[model samples]
Target: MNTTPAQLPHALVMIRPRSFGSNPQTIGSNTYQQTDEGLAEEEMNEQARKEYDDMVAALKKADITVLSFDDRTDPVCPDAIFPNNWFSTHPDGTLALYPMMAKNRRTERRQDIVDYLEAHYELKQVVNFAPFEKGSRFLEGTGSMVFDHTHGIAYACRSPRTQQEVFYKACETLGYKGILFEARDEGGRLIYHTNVMMWIGSNIAALCLEAIPEKQRNEVLTSLEASGREILLLTQKQVNSFAGNMLEVSDPEGSPHVVMSAAAWASLDSKQQELIKSQAHPLPLSLDHIEKYSGGSARCMMAGIHLPLKPGATP
Candidate 1:
């Protein structure tokens, strides 16, 4: 029932201006357009890079510690923005590498990023689940499993991208328990990403409870209540604006900030705004082109690296 680590005192986020055609995992969503109006791969990449640069500048202005990295040619990897899906950093300085669903996405797991992180932060262990890919079983990291780090509980929406066995194994590896649920959109389609439907903050959690089936709604509600989290429920319309896909981060001065896309913020009602501001300052950046083409908002672009606090210091 704990809820502190979920509020990131420090985080590592990525920006994608050249985000198009990068995430092969979204092929099921038909994320790509077949019409000529669709951007060429090169053009999309260029635009994505530019958007990413702009986003980084905005975060820097807020004094957020950002570890930025450009896509490299070493492996021709795609869908790198969802780095949280490929790997997760733990408070104990351990790293967990997940098994990706898409063939192209498997290539996105780069050792170089891990090497860089190790140099800057303390790294104790590296637990990899990529071998599951050999058996065709997948469990995309935060995209599939949402960890309540403070309580050591992992909540995951059932989907093709999230296998139940893999989910259990991940929890076991992390010394946590798993709470599996089924979440569907208004159209009754399974939500593609866990972050799209629910986001856990320090004292608050933004979720689209309407997406849960009647049979499972109470279970989800009970879990949230049990965790001592204040809920900020969103409607179907808000979910479309990426409302639930938000991350609570901190500035270099250690002040809490809620990060989301401008589009998501625009969809919020005054009440929702008040509820969010009660917890942290709102930070909304323009990711129109990036979101329109990538179908991932601000939260998807970030990978929170919860390294241990330094000696005699506050994180």
Candidate 2:
């Protein structure tokens, strides 16, 4: 099995936050985000803007094409900065809209972004899963699951935010095999989103396997191993540091670079750092305020634009 054969997205969609903050609706499932009652609205938006700008600048420096869209504040989507939860694009030119658990987050399905992309790229079809939200069954896009595009595998941790029926439906549509498992935090609470616990790259899968149920551990390991992906196990502390939150993308020169947050990079020991470096150049974005408040890190902010480019064009 050939690992690391360019699973990177050609372009990245980052929704620059206008009103980023801790969302109360997500608190039940997302233990990572806490409502900071003392923080004022203006302060939240300002810090988020600074963090968003810095991350965008760093991604551009690495030669990764980044599209920064301003988030809407009128309807008020507090967690709008994490756009990966709302939609995902595919190389087949299919755009899939996910069913968000939060009512306000459901409002995040913005056609304007799609329209903007259509003006630039080639999109074949749109898959709407938003109707599932009507029945209260939700599956937040890339947040609820991580796709190993090359392997035809979708690894997802079971949570209220991710339902099996919805997962299976999506897998059927995307031609992916759904691998379901239960994962918990240190306090025995379910991990809100699979992306926060693990990430599947072209050649490697990084995750805190200990959090997964023991019964399902072998199955998960077997699946990745069968695909010849090098598994990088993370500790609970590292998971909290957002170590699992990473994405691989090619630079302007076509060199693969792995993007992560400063907090996540700091948690790596010497050996782990070298292993990652061997695969791709490390591009760490400073997003402390964004991570602390939004409960999501680098990977969550990046919505992979997998559509085809124009003739003689590059992302």
Candidate 3:
């Protein structure tokens, strides 16, 4: 049997947003969001599509499997390009669906995608956490919590989008240890997503330690050290540039590739770049329009597909 590494997935699921733009509903907590006054809505959508296509092509060219889906037009999900927030797959055949902070984003959890995955993969259990939204508790999949699958740890920052109780419940459900912390951006607003401030790869962990409170930094630092990962410290400015928002994927030959935005790559200094290069090949995509409108980068656009394939299923 062929198996993928726990920390790195060889396949990803991505959604191409047709009506892609900055989501007004998410603007309150997502300080990183900004609208492009220069481009009209149609132009913005066209640019986003182009960027999305280019990213998918690049990932596929690198020998990583990409399952692409088109976004629905009826409800008009502006932030649909970032599908990582809706659901996550596991090697244990557990498909976890999360409760979203934005009502519009909640609609991104389409039944067709779930059905397709179940047909192609070994989906043993479907753990739906969407019910928690009724109580006003939210946990937006990978956006709310970043999982260190190799160590069974889920690193999360507490915010309106990431509730404490719900995050622990997800950890318990996935059989992971929940390492909850508080992180704030430069303006002292709570970081919207854990993935926006930190990224944990197989052998490397990149994070903006300054975003985390002084008293709470040691736990995250100690945990990363204990996990045997080399830490690449990021500045708050870099985090704002989406430096912390990266995903480490593996090719068919099990070689690592760090997928990030051009802005994110430019934010890194020589030392940080070298450290990342030492661990994985840097694959930066230019997502200028998407980043400006959606406030998400390459990492947020991909949902890693970690489920084992069913009999005779192609990756």
Candidate 4:
């Protein structure tokens, strides 16, 4: 398989339901848990499941190739739909498994999923990084690191869920340079995932500039400029709506399409919408319940696999 990043022309996105989980990195995860008089645990899980199914149907209607998984098993994995945090695929057909920070989340990784993909798709190599979990070092795959494949740059924000060592190793192994920085929300709380603040597309990037500290903002700006990507800066409010978490995907005809949540689309200003429309067609799906309950939006649920087209190409 061709290992060159540029060779990847397709992406694999997962539809998430039952996405609500008690993630340690989320700002208000505990609030989602069952309370004495609030919603029952089973009810919340059921609602999340319904929302996930609706979002999946929306994506399918948009012509996005989705890989749907069932969650009918025991010890429900609430965050199973957001697979990007646990695994990533490369153009050379290499699959990299990551170590997650949440104990319940670690169970999201299913060998059966890999086996299924291998049975249908052409897989070249599998690299496991789950050993870091034993050492208490975590790096939640593409959720923690956003890759600019065209320029060989991997952007990451430092957080308890993203370890520097693991981030550096991922960059080195993938032949990319790491641009690391710290980001915080208005409350001065660290952003849980890099996807919440920025998303790198083929020739453009949607970013929440206000979330990045003043000290690191210039560096990020310089890097984006150096990479020759157009910057679509978003506000904190828009980021909360999942605007910055949008993903750029291509159709089977090689037409580029930008995928975002309906909340994200509604949050964009007319000018911002025009700017994005000038580049690619916008595909929005409603994931309101998933975002509110899981604290992750459309982009978090999709894991873009940079796999080569043919089986013999290097990834």
lDDT of 1 by residue, 47-133 (tens): 767767787888778878788877766556557766778888888788899998888778778787888777666778899998999
Ranking by lDDT: 3, 2, 1, 4
- Top lDDT model: 3
**1 or 3, greater by lDDT:** 3
Local distance difference test scores for all models:
0.77, 0.86, 0.91, 0.75
Candidate 4 residue spans exceeding 4 A from truth: 1-9, 15-37, 309-315
* Candidate 3 Cα RMSD (Å): 1.1
Tell me the lDDT of model 2 at 178.
Answer: 93
* Model 3 residue pairs with clashes: none
Judged by TM-score relative to the true structure, which candidate is superior, 2 or 3?
3
Those runs of model 1 whose alpha carbons end farther than 4 Å from true positions after fitting are 1-6, 13-19, 22-25, 29-37, 309-315
* Best-first order by TM-score: 3, 2, 1, 4
Candidate 4 least-lDDT 10 residues: 28-37
> What C-alpha lDDT does candidate 2 achieve relative to the native structure?
0.86
Candidate 2 wrongly placed segments (more than 4 Å): 1-6, 312-315
Candidate 2 lDDT over 138-220, as tens digits, reads 99999998988877889999899999999999999987899999999999999989999898877778989999989999999
Error of 4 at 38 (Å): 2.4
TM-score pick, better of 3 and 4: 3
